[model samples]
Target chain A: MDNSQLFFDFAPIWQARTLLLEGFGIAMFSAVAGIFFAILLGLIVALMRLSRYRALRAIAFTYTQLFRGVPLYVLVLWIYFGLVYAVGIDIPRIPSGIIALALLNSGYLSETFRSGILAVEKGQREAGEALGLRPWQVSRFIVLPQAGRIVVPPTGNQFVDAIKDSAILSIIGVPELMKVAQEQANMYYRPFEFYTVAGLLYLIAVIIVSKGISKLEQRLARFSRASKEASSGERRPSEVGG
Target chain B: MSETLLQLRNVGKRFGDHVVLKDINLDIAKGEVVCVIGPSGSGKSTLLRCINFIAPPEEGEVIFEGRTWKRFHSAFNFIANRKYEAKLPTLRAEIGMVFQHFNVFPHMTAIENVVLGLTKVRGNTRNVAREIAERSLRQVGLGDKLDQYPEKLSGGQKQRVAIARALALNPKVMLFDEVTSALDPELVTGILDEMRRLASDGMTMVVVTHEMNFAFQVATRIVFMDAGRIVTIGTPEEIRNTTEPRARAFLSSILG
Candidate 1:
C-alpha cells in the first residue's frame, strides 16, 4: 500500500463522535462514582488503621495490603466474573466496574489519607482535647479539616488515575470509552482513527478535572485566609484594622 | 490556700523506661497562678500536661474539682476504656491548656478557633459561642485579627487566639505550656502582659515558663523541677533566696 493510503483519515472520527461522546459520559460516571465511594471508604479505613485497638489496625492493614497488592484488571474481573460463579450473585456491568475501581483506589487513598492525618500537628489534637472535645469530635472537627487541606493535591492525582483506570472496565463489556472505541474501530475498519479520538476524549476530561481541582485548592486556601470575618463583624466596631 | 482546685498525688509518667515525671505531688488552689520553671529536660511541660491529662499519669492520680482519674484508660481493657472515654470529656472540660507552639487551628479563622470548643464541647449555640469567642478574643487584644487564619497571624497573635480558644470554654483552670516561648523577643511582653491580666482576674492557672521575670512577678508560687522531680517549690521571694544547691544552680543559670 502507498503511504497516502495508510494516512490518517478524519472522516471516521467525525462520524462516530456521538457514540464516542456517549461512551465518554459512561466512563466519567464510573470514575466519579468510584472516586466518591473511594473517598468515604478510604477515610474509614485510614481511621481504622490509626485506631488504638490492635484488632482494628490489623484488619485495616490487611485490607490495604490485599487490595493494593492486586492489579486493577484482576480486581475488575474478580468482581465481574469470580463473584458470580462463587457466590451465585452477579453484579451488573457498571456497578461491578465501579466496585472494582473503588476497592482498588480506596487501598491507595487510605494510605494517602493516613499520611495526611498524621501530618497534622499533634498539638492540634491536644488543643481540641484540651477544650473538652470527645476523641471523635476532635478528629471530625479539627484533625480532619486540617488533613483535608493537606490531602487535596494528592487526592486530585488519584481522581485522574481513576479516570484512566475506568478504561479497564471495557473487558467486562461496560461500553465505556475503550469498549466503544473497540467496537467502532472494528465496524469502520479504522482502528487508529477511533482509538485516537477516545484517547483525546480521556485527555480532555482529565485536563478539565485537574483544572477544577486546582481551582478548588485555591478557593480553600483563600477561604482559610478571610472566611467568617463577616459573621463575627456584627460585634466588631466598623474599623477593620490589620 | 483557698479550696484546692487541682491536685496531683504521686503522679508519675514515662515514655518507655525514660521517666518524664516522677512522683509529682502538687496542689493548685483556686484563683492561684502556679508557675513551673526548670531546665530543658526537667519535665516542667510534662507536669503541666498531667494537670489536663494531655500526658496521662502512668502511676498515681490526678484529682480536679473533687473528681479523679487514675492513669489513662488502657486499650487492652476495651469495655472499661469506653466508659473512661465517655467520662474524660467532662473531666477535661473543667481544665484548659495552651501549647508552646500556639496550636491554633490553621484552617480556622481566629473566631472559629475560639468558637469550636464552645459549640462542639459545651453545646452552645453558634450565636452564644460567637459572643463568648468575641469577648475572649477581645480580652486577649486580638479583636482586629478575629477573621485571620493562624497562618496569617504572627506568633504572638496565634498564641492569643489559642488563649481565646481555651478561655471561651470558661474552664475552671487554665494550663499554659511555655505559651510565650515561641514569640519573637519583642512580642514576648505582650503575651506576658495578657497573662498578667488573666492572673489579676483571679483565673486559676498553671504556667510552664522560661521567662524568669514574668514568673517572679505573676506566679503565686514557683515550682523548680529537675530530672523529672520537683527539686523545690516556694513563693517567688523564697525561690529567689533558695538554699538548695540544685535549685540554686538552676536559678543562677537562668539569671546569667
Candidate 2:
C-alpha cells in the first residue's frame, strides 16, 4: 500500500510500452477504418431511405433497424468468432472487428444522415426547383452542401464512439488496446495498473478527436452562417448523435 | 410584345382537404408586369406558385410558349405538376421564381450562385456561364459584390443576387413571391427599384407583393385577390379607382 511499492509494481509497464503503443495504433486504425466505411455506407443508406421509391426506403429502414437493434459487443463477437463456427469461414479478427463496428455505426449514422438532410431549410430545395434543377440535382448541389455543414459535428462524435467501441473486439483476440492491456496485466498479475493505462489512453484519444471536431465545426461555420442568413435561425440539428 | 405568353386557366390547389387556391385564372402577356396583391391569407402568392408549378394546381392547364401543360389529369395533360418531373427542368428554366426569403446558395459566392444553374442545368461551358453570370450580376447592380456570400450581403443585396441568379437563366416569365417582404423598411425600396428596372427592360413578370405603392406605380395589370380567388383584375389605375366592395375593402386595409 506504500508509495514506493506502487511505483515498483508499475515498473513493468515501461517494458511493455512497445506492446501498448502497437495496441493503441491498432485501436486507432480500427476506429478510423470503421468510421470511414460507415460514413460512406451510411450516406448511401440515408439517400435510399429518402428515395421516392417505397421499396428502397423499406429496405434501408429494415437494415438500419436490424443493425442498430443488435448490441455492438454481440455484433463484434458474432462477426469474429461465430463466422468460423456457424458460417464455416474464418475471418481474421481485425477485419471482422472493423466490419462489425462499421455496420453498427452505419446503422446509427444513416438515421443521423437523414436528420441532417431534413434539417436543411426547405428554401434550399425550392430554390433549386425554381432554378430548373431536377430533384436529384437539387439534392446534390443545393441540399447536400447545406446539410453537410450540419452533419459533420455529429458524424465526428460517432468516430469517437467507434474508438471506444473498438475495445470490445479485444475479446475475440483482435490485439487492440484492451487486449494488450489485459495480456500485460495477466502476465504480471497487475490488472489495476495496466487497466488504468488503457483507460487513460482512451480518454486521451477521445479528447484529441473532440478537439478535431471543434476545429472542423468552426471551419464549416462560415458556410452554414451564409446559407442560414435569410431564414430564421431556428431548430439546429447539429446534435443528431452523441 | 402584347401577345399573351403565359395563361393560367381554372388553376386550383389543395393541401389535403384545406383548399388554398380555387378556380384561379390569369393571363400574362409579354412585356407586362402583372402584380398580384392581397392580405396575408389571400392567394396572391399561391397563384404565382401555381404558375411556376411550385404548388401544382389540382385542376387546370398552364399554356406557355403555345404548348399547354396539362396540370391535373395524367392521361390528357402533357405535363402534370408532380408527374412532369422530366419536363420540369425545361419548364422551370422558362419561368424563374424568387422566394420571399431570398434562397441564395450560401456556400457559393454571389457570382457562383448565379453561375451554378447555367453551368450545371443548362450545360453551359464555364466561360460562357461566367460571362452570363457577370452580366446578370451587373444588371442587378451587384457587379462589385459578386464575390461576397449571402451572409456578407445586406437583405437588399441578397435579393438582388437572387434576381441576378434567376436572370442568368434568361427566363421568359420571372415569378416573384414577395421578394421584398422580408427586407427592412429601408432595404425594401432597393429591391423594388431593381424590380422596376426589370419591368422597364421588358421582362414579363408575375409578382406577389404586399407593397401597395410599387404595385400601383409599376403593375401593368393588378390582380386583387382574397381567400384564394381573384376579386378584381384591371389596370393599376382601374384597381386604384375601383368601386367593388371586395376590392375596396381589401385595398383600404393594406393601403391604410
Candidate 3:
C-alpha cells in the first residue's frame, strides 16, 4: 500500500505458470484448427465465386459479404449464445469459439484465394487445356500452383492475425491465453504483470510465423519472377480480424 | 492427295453480337502444311482455336479424323458443351497447339513443361515421361536448357519449349497460332526454321502466320482470309497470281 516506490511482481506469474501454459496451449490449438478449416473452406468458396453457374456464384458472394460485413466479436456472440437459443442446439464453448474464428477468417481467406486464382493468366489455363489436361487437372497442376505463390504472403499475414484474434474467444470463457491472464490478474491483483506476459506470448508466435512465411515465399519465387513483381504494390485488404 | 484429316463445315462464331467468323468451310489433308494469312482480326486465330474446340464454333460442325463435333443449340448448348468437354481431352492430345505467347507453364522447367502432358494426360511413368520430355527438348535445341524455368528462357527459346511440349505428345496434327509474333525479328528465324523442319518431316500442320516468306516456302497451301471468310485458297504460286481484290490488296500491302 506504500506509494514510496513503483514496484512490479513476477511471483504471481511464476505461481500460475502451469495454468497459463495450458491456456496458451488451448489458444494455439484453436488458432491452428481455425486457420486450417478456414483455408479449406476458403478454397471451395473461391471456386464457387468463380463458378460458371449464377446460382453458385450468388450464394458464394452472399456468404463472403455477410461474414465480412459482420464484426468478429458479434459473430462469436451470435454463434456461441444466439445460435443455441435461436436454433435449438446447444454448442460447447470451445467448438463455438473455433467455429466463430473459422467463419470470420474464411471470408477474408476466400477473398485472398479468389484474387490469387484470378491473378493467374487466362493463357495458363488455356495452355493446360490445350495439353489435354482435364479441367480439374488444369486447376490442380497449373493454375493453383501459380496462384499459390501469389497468395502465400497474404495468407501468412492472415495466420498471424488469426493467432491474435484467438484472444477474443476468452470472452466466451474458452480458457485461452487471455482468459488465463484474466483469472491470474484477478486472483493476485497483478493485472499489469499477467497481461504483459500474455502479450509477449502472442508476439513470439507472430515472429515465428512471419519467419516461416518468408522462407516459403523465397522457395516459391524460384519458379516465376512474376510472383515477385506481383507481390509488390498489391492493395492490402482493410484489417478486420482483430 | 492424302486422306482428309480434319474438316470445318459451315462453322460460325460470334462474341455477343459481333460475328468473328461465319460459314467457314475448309479441309485439311494428312501431312499437309496449310498456312493461314491475313490482317489482324481476320479470324485466323479464332479458326485455329475452333479446331480443338478451345473456342467452340456456335454453328456447324468440326469433323476430325472422321468424328463430328457440332453444337445443337446456341443458348442451351451446355449439353453439347459437356459432351465436347468429355471427348476433348483425348482429341486434344492428338491435336497439339502452340500459341503466339508461347504459353509454356512458368512454374515448370522446360523439361517439366514438356513432361506434364505425358505423365498426367497420357499417364506415362515419371521416368518414361522424363525421357520423352528430354528428347522433345533436344529436338527443339533446348536439351542443355531443360532444367531452366520459363523466365530464364528467351522469347524464341520459350516458343521452342512450347513447340516441344506439343511435340512430346506425338500428335497427329499441330496447330500454330501466330507462334512467332511475340519474338524479336532476329529470333523469328529460329522458330520458322524449326517449323520448316516439322513440315518437311510430313507433320500435318495448320499455321497462322504473318511471315509471308515462311508461308510461301513451307506451306503446301495458303489460305487468305478477310472479314471472317476465306478469300482465297491455293498453292503459293496460285496465291501469288490471285486476282481477288481483297487477297491481292492484302498481299501487296504486306509484301510491299
Candidate 4:
C-alpha cells in the first residue's frame, strides 16, 4: 500500500512476466490476423466503390458508412454479444473478437484505398487504355500498382493502430496484453508498475513498425527514381493544336 | 480519293450545361496526317479524345476501318459506357494517343513502357516485346534510354517515350493532343522532328497542335476550329491563301 513499495517492487512484475508474455503473444497474433483480413476486405470494398455498377457502388458505400460511423468498441460488442447471442452461434470469443476488429478496421481502410486509387491521375488510366489494355487489365497492372505506392504509408499506420486496438478484445475475456496487465495488477496489487510496463511494450512495437514502414517508403522512392532514369531518352511528339 | 480509315457523324459533347462540341462531321483517310488547330477550350482536344473512346461523345457514331457504326452514350451511373463497350480493346489497339503532359508510367523503364502493350495486349513474349520496344525506342532516337524511368528524363525525352509507347502498339491511327505544349521552348523542335519522321513514314496521324509552323510543314490537311466547330479544312497552301477575316486574324496573331 505504501508508495515506495508500489514504486520499487520489480518483484511482482518479474513474477508475472510469463503471464504478460502469454498476453503479448495473443495480442500480437490477433493483431496480425486482424490486419490480414482488414487488407483483404478493404481492397474488395475499395474496388466496389470504384465499380461502374450503381448498385455495387451503393452497397460498398453503405457498408463503409455503416462501419465507420459506429465506434470500434460498439462494433466489438455487437459482433461478440449482439450477433452471436441473437443468432445463438457458439463461436469462440477470440475468433469473434478478431473478426469484429478486422471488419471495423476495413471500413476506414477502404476509404484510404479509394482515395489512393483516385489520387492517381486520370491520364495514367488513359495511357493504359491507349496501350490496348482491357479496363480490368488497366486497374490490375497500372492503376493498382501506382495506387499501392500512395496507399502503403497510411495502411501501415492503420496496422499500428490495430495493434494497439487489440487491447479492446480484453473486454470479451480474450486475454490480450491489457487483460494480462489487469490480471497481474489485481493479483499482486501493483496497478501502476504493471500497466506502465504494458504501455511501454505497446510503444516499442509501434516504433518498430514505424521504422519498417519508413524503410519501405524509401525503397519505393528509389525504385521510382531508377525507373525514371532508365527511360529518359525520347522527345515528345508535337501537339496537334499547341 | 484515299480510303477513309476513320469517320465521325453528328458528333456532339456536352458537359453539364456547357456544350463542348456540336454536330461534328469529319473523315480521315488511311495514312493521312490531319492537324486540328484551334484556341484553348475549342473542343479540338475533346474531339481527339472522343475518337479513342476516352471521352465518349454524348451523341455520335464513330466508324473505324469501314466497320459498323458504333455509338457512344454517356452512362450517368457508370465509370464508362457499357452498351457500346465491345471491341474497345481491338479499337484502342488500332488507335494510339499521346497527351500534353506525357503521362508516362513513372514506375516503368522506357522499354517497359513500350513493351507492356506488346506483351500484355499483343501477347508477345518478353524477349520479342523487348526487341520491338528497343526498335521503337531507337526509332525515336532513345535507344540508350531503355532502362531510364520517366522522372529521370527531361520533359522532351519523357514525351518521346510516350510517343514510342504509342508507336510500339503499331496503331493504325495516332492522336496527339498538344503533346509538346508542356515542353520547354528549346525542347519543342526535338519532339516535332521525331513526329515529322513518323509522318514521312505514312503513319495515320491526327495532331491537335498550337505550333502553326509544324502544322504547315507536316500536316497534309489542316482543319481550323473555333467555338466548337470547324471554320475551314484545307491544305497548307489553301489555308495560307484564305482571306476569311477570322482565319486572317488567327494567322496574324500567331505569326506576329
Best lDDT among the predictions, by candidate number: 3
lDDT of 4 by residue, B66-159 (tens): 8744553445734344534756778889898998888888878899999889999999999999999999999888988899977678889989
For candidate 4, write residues A1-242 as lDDT tens digits: 76455555767888888999899889988988998899899999999999978899999999999878988788788888888679877668789879977988899899999998887767789889877799988998888898888888999999999999999999888988999999889888888889999999899989998999999989788545543343242233333232
Candidate 3, A1-242: lDDT as tens digits: 64323378888799999999999999999998999989988999999999989999999999999888998899889988998899877889989888988888899999999999998877788889999999899999999999988899999999999999999999889999999999999988888999999999999999999999999988887765754432331232211000
Candidate 2 wrong stretches, greater than 4 Å? A1-8, A83-85, A227-229, A233-242, B71-83
CAPRI verdict on model 2? acceptable
Compared with the true structure, what per-residue lDDT tens digits does model 2 show for residues B1-256?
Answer: 4799999888888778877788888888999999888767776776787787776788887899787876555556544435665786788888888877788888889999988999987899999999999999998888899898787888889889899999899889898988876778999988898889889989998888878899999999999888878889999999989999989988888777
Candidate 3, clashing residue pairs?
Answer: none
Clashes of 3: 0
For every model in order, the fraction of real contacts preserved is 0.59, 0.66, 0.52, 0.48
Instruction: Compose the digit string of candidate 2's lDDT tens values, residues A1-242.
Output: 65445644777678899999999999999999999999999999999999988999999999999899999989988887788899788889999999999999999999999999998878788888889898888998888888888899899899999999999989889999999999999998788889999999999999999999999999888887765554563232311100
Q: Could you report the DockQ of all the candidates, in the order they appear?
A: 0.36, 0.42, 0.36, 0.42
- lDDT scores of the candidates, listed in order: 0.86, 0.86, 0.89, 0.85
Model 3 DockQ reads: 0.36
Error of 1 at B77 (Å): 5.4
Error of 3 at B27 (Å): 0.5
TM-score for each of the candidates:
0.93, 0.92, 0.94, 0.92
Interface RMSD of 2: 8.4
Residue B236 CA error for candidate 4 (Å)?
0.6
The better-scoring model by lDDT among 1 and 3 is: 3
